[model samples]
Target: MSNKRGKGPMGFGGPMGGAVHGGAKAKDFKGSSKKLLNYLKPYRLSIIIVLIFAIGSAAFSIIGPKILGKATTKLFEGLVSKVSGTAGAGIDFEYIGRIIIILAVLYLISALFSFIQGYIMSGIAQKVSYNLRKEISIKINKLPLKYFDKLTHGEVLSRVTNDVDTVSNTLNQSLSQIFTSFTTLIGVLIMMLSISVSMTLVSVLILPLSAILISFVVKKSQRYFKEQQNFLGHVNGHVEEIYGGHNIMKAFNGEEKAVKEFNELNETLYNSAWKSQFLSGMMMPIMSFIGNIGYVLVSILGGYLAVKKTIEVGDIQSFIQYIRSFTQPISQAAQIANVLQSTAAATERVFEFLEEEEESDNLSTPVDINEIKGSVEFKNVHFGYNEDKIIINDFSSKIKPGQRIAIVGPTGAGKTTIVKLLMRFYELNSGEILLDNTNITSFKRSDLRKVFGMVLQDTWLFNGSIMDNIRYGRLDATDEEVLEAAKAAHVDHFIKTLPDGYNMELNEDASNVSQGQKQLLTIARAILADPKILILDEATSSVDTRTEVLIQKAMDNLMNGRTSFIIAHRLSTIKDADLILVMKDGDIIEQGNHKELLEKKGFYASLYNSQFENSEAS
Candidate 1:
């Protein structure tokens, strides 16, 4: 099944869509922010302690300069007094050195604590990301097949890789930076007030303008941020389509069309990316300009105050340095605000999947089929992929234990759909399908699928050893059992000649293996299961005529004691069936054995004769 086919054909307008009971989720950035904070609740104490250390670290870093300034001013004051003879003045250089050494010790303690806090916070962030990834992966497994039926492989992968990565980085980088910025701002403001409350007032006159600029930039950046994520989704969807259908494009001579379509999508992606980055990039410059204007105002104002002897020169100098520290952190904090918004958008998408409702099943236990009787019955079965497009209407059938049933149909006939219903992939809209007099709906889905083994036209294999691929049918099957199944499928001889024999690693999508070989492996897997109900869906379509003959013999042996349902276009292959059903337009129009259907001289007879003549001609 290709992932790009969203929701399935039943989605009507969309290709391969899934159940769309709910529309797109409506989530706000505020909600995402709250959820992220909740994830940190377990480490609140550590977070607070880290914050305290961060404040102390920045404060101590600022203290060295203040202490040096005070000591220098006192030394100069004593020199002036000594020269003017106003009083006997003495300054102790020793005491100044001791004070400087004490300040150094304080800064060292702060640095040590800062390092420890950084390591612990980062550890918490990484742990959170790891837990989230594991939780999402487990949730994905529990999701119903219908959910996967609608979503593309690349879109889901983006949720895992892109969304999770964004969230992880925000926790590790933005959250911590936010803490440091706020603390630095508060600490610097307090120091400024202590130095001169009046001067502090003058310095922050430009702050309102800075705040407004930051808010405007952030508000505008929000839309572009959202558009960027949406465009990224489109890009991922496009890439998945192109890669999966590269061969199809070449076959249809659509390479130029594909390139043009892809380029248009890429261009939209580029525009969105530029808009998002451009808006964020403006934050630094706008804030920088405002801070510089504030600095100039404070410098000129402080000089006036100093000349009037209202504040000391050293105090004005210290005040300006504090303002510098404060502005840098304030501007950085604004940028963190913008980054967090973008991260929240991604978080919202991720949690939307987490919150999605999956299909529900009430059956707790199923009849274990150690030996299935293979009696299948469709009792007044009514089914449809959608309400508007009914595939089977009042369909009924009964297959006696160990009987062989052949279903013949045109392209839109419900033959293949019958098999899907029999397996209970999609529940019938208003009827029951019974197996050996028991309703299949009463059985667990896993147990129901286990009763049958299938070989389909599309041959799929994993990137593992041949033994592992075959052993997928019955996980407990041993090496000898696998080899036996392969032998029965007429694939063992080829496997033995390959490099490393059955241990050879398959390549991407098993592309290195031949199409016939891939089909043989799936058939071997089905054989290893030794199921009660066997379905061969054009099983030998890819093989040459010689291999087809061999495969038919192998399939006959495999289906000897099982109830078999075969869907094939090749009419000659089903001549020995006990019951032959010819269907058209979702309804069975003709029936009976080969000889009886020929006598009816109806749709079945014409189809049989035409195919008979084609065989004769060949």
Candidate 2:
């Protein structure tokens, strides 16, 4: 019952942040990236098409400045000739018009290519996200209950929502940016060199300074980004916990504590977020200043070259444009690096969940559930949530078919653990549980579980109509059958009294109904299941004494000719049980008929007497 397992992969605060400003580095960047890329293998041809489109877009855009430079040179030549009173003295508007048309076509093509690639990439990203969410949903069912014991609901939800979105966004936006940036960088550099090597050298000289400054800022900001992501997850988790238990917090006067905790987490997140954003904000200005210096140098050099007629005036214009284009990609590449880190972190968490050890079904040919009898036995079972600390030791018991058995004990006496072991929720460290003298492991877990119906202390109902919630016990059950089960559980009158009868919808937490109603609904579900073996763990504890008596009668009718195991703290409830199992310190201290145990004046008798005294006092 003491689940002391270590935190699962998603248990560190929660999932990492989704944005570039709050990107966290992966523990195994290369490994995680490799795994992530594997998901894209199915769309390899689409990705290739995206790459081609992206490159074409960048290439076409990069060629525009150089071509426009030709028009500038032509215009300058005609103006100079006109100033000199030459034969060709006027500007050639026709030539300039033709160049304008070419430039317009080029830019239009570039935009079209960009749009097409973006459209394709968006689809790919969404499909990948869909696949990931689907896998996570399926994995939730496949995971053992112990896995959930080590993780919070928020942590698991974060992976399915936030982490997967991060990967998807990165794939959609950043991926195409990467292709375009590199292509632009290369094409712009080549054009710059072709225009004027001397100016190109001067322009390229500023890059080292830009790189050094960008690197310094990135190095300083990386830790803050990581911290931002960490704190973001903590804030999210805290908010989820507080919101989910709003009523409990109010009842306990915990609003101040909750607010204080939120403020602390929010403060940390604000600090990290601003610091990372400020540092990242510095990159563009720094690059621009460095680029301005390059521009100044290029301009002065181009003027000298132009004075000497070494290079055309338009070439200088083109070279300056190329220098500006070149620095843009460098800035983009730097940002993309951080984005990649975030993507890797997100993908790593998703992959970790997907790769978690699923519950193994070792039975190749499982025993049929229909062949199983109601007889149950536990033989010398030794088990623990954590192997080093055993909770159930040398515990053994047997129940004949149709026997009404009650397991009574103080809290943590391993009473619940016995039922958990019987259902194979957690594998026993040693010993075997038998269903009609056959080892339980011989049956598939799904098939074995079909033989039992459980109505526990905690009732669970999803957001649905009362009819749907009840019919969850047997998915194929018709409305008539569901109504029959509800009546049998004594919940029919309650349902009919409501506004919509069984059609009334439960809210997200099913809070519209009272505690007793929820319990009745669960009982209704179990009755609809009509399982051969039944487990009632404090099943009627929520209802009032009058309702409890009514439910008891209904349960008695339902339990007739069925094997039933009842675990209860109210000893008076089980006075007529055919057998009472008294558990103490993970072992059965005494077990016999209720009257026989009371006559013995031992542990069971004392437990029953104490409960009886408490009832009398109340």
TM-score per candidate, chains pooled: 0.84, 0.94
Poorly placed runs, candidate 1 (over 4 Å): 1-26, 36-107, 218-279, 359-365, 608-618
Tell me the whole-model lDDT of each prediction, alpha carbons only.
0.76, 0.87
Q: Report the lDDT tens digits of candidate 2 across residue range 218-308.
A: 7897788777767776776677677777889999999998888888878987998788778777776887789889888999999999999
lDDT of 1 by residue, 1-618 (tens): 121322211000111110111112225978987877787799788788777777677777767556665765667666767778875566767777887788779779868867876887788878877877887897787676557778767568767776777677767766767776777788778888877788788777778888888778766765665555555556666667777788887899888877787788678868866775676677678867887787788878888987897766667667777877887776665556555665777688788888877545666575766656999988788877776888887878889988888998878788888998898777688888989989987777777889999999998898899999999999999999999999999899989999988999998699888888898899999999999999988888798888889788889999998999988888788889888888887777887888899899999888878988988999
Q: Where is the poorest 10-residue window by lDDT in model 2?
A: 7-16
Residue 430 lDDT (model 2): 97
lDDT of 1 at 78: 69
- Which candidate leads the pack in lDDT? 2
lDDT of 2: 0.87
